[model samples]
Target: MLPTVILPGYLESADVYLPLQQALTALGTPTTTVPLRKRDWLPTLGGRSMIPILRQLDRTVSAALVDNQAAQINLIGHSAGGWISRIYLGDIPYTIHGDVTEAEQLWNAKAKVANLITLGTPHISGERWTKKNLDFVNDNYPGAKHPEVRYVCVAGKSIYGEKKLGQWLAYSSYQQTCGEGNTWGDGITAIKAAHLTGAINIEIEGVKHSPRTPGIWYGSPAVLPQWTGYLS
Candidate 1:
């Protein structure tokens, strides 16, 4: 099987995904985490342009392809990494905010991508930093409609954040991500937003947004059975 490249979420470093990478390796899918960090993403985040980060992801993809010596590789992206992977898979145009320059194509889609698995990714975002970029992703790629690649979306159902302490943290995150907090979600992302219309959608009962001390996220060993099958 081709090795899987794991992409971390926003403001997260590559090391944060080590637990999940270990789990996937044990499950027979060799994995690698993209060496990404918050400092590397600061430019794109502040400038509202995803060009730099997308380039970084592409470099990782190229390295994975060389390391595994395969024509195609599996992509596992968490949170914003998921949508960013979509942009990486095609020749999509992107522009910097407040810049009058013409939009540029970040990736040329020459790399072969076999499967794409997303964990608690908020495909839709209401925040200004991601809204326009996500709009481009949703409009062009739109769900798992890509003809060549298999798309799998994994969602968490542990915290809805409707009231109390959960409301303050998880609910606020949900509201920021999807514009509502009275629904079932993984505290950071909503199930409905995490899934694409034509993709393989899965909902885990107690998964959180990421691996925590007492609970597991999508890549934790406890929940490997839920979405590992798609790695093939």
Candidate 2:
């Protein structure tokens, strides 16, 4: 059986992905969501600790795929999970200020995989929170291409706020959120951003950061239709 790997963001876990996973399972897809151990502040400090975050995802994705004998891995991410997918395929480097000597980008380009589904992910040059992540995607992945790895992005339109996905105050000076008229655009960009980057884009209508039909983090039913299209 093929593998459909769904990843949860910071505090998000099997519970958050349960609804989405069950929905996919109905389609005859063997779905699995790997819940990273709950971290109190790692996500809130993504900027300073992004390297560690990316590393954990890399190891997890790699091991899960191999152990399950998954012939192909279909990737799906929400918020921080979306950011993780971007890091995995696009070799864009995010310099943790001057902290590390060598700049680290998301994903080991060599990791074999198929398809990337990004939900409510921010990847534009100038969104409310692009400075930290965009630094790499913009600089390194401009004309970049990942063979055998197709990508689909689905952004939200609701009024919501999330730690890894939002631009807000944090325990450390690293995290950014969608606070104070930050308007709708959280740290991640919406639909237009992905299209501009040349991805196989699937724009979902009637969804927002949060407070809309689907409830931001866990994801909204309005956006699930888009996910079904991609995850399938």
Task: Supply candidate 1's per-residue lDDT for 15.
Answer: 80
lDDT of each: 0.79, 0.54
Candidate 1 residue 117 C-alpha distance from true site, Å: 0.3
Models, CA RMSD each: 2.5, 6.4
* Number of the predicted model whose TM-score against the real structure is largest: 1
TM-scores of the models, in the order given:
0.90, 0.67
Model 1, global lDDT: 0.79
Task: Give the 10-residue window scoring lowest on summed lDDT in candidate 2.
Answer: 170-179
- Which runs in model 1 stand beyond 4 Å of their true positions? 95-105
Q: Mind sharing the TM-score for model 1?
A: 0.90
Model 2 residue runs over 4 Å out of place are 10-14, 37-46, 90-106, 109-111, 125-130, 158-189, 194-196, 210-223
Q: Give residue 191's error in model 2 in angstroms.
A: 3.3
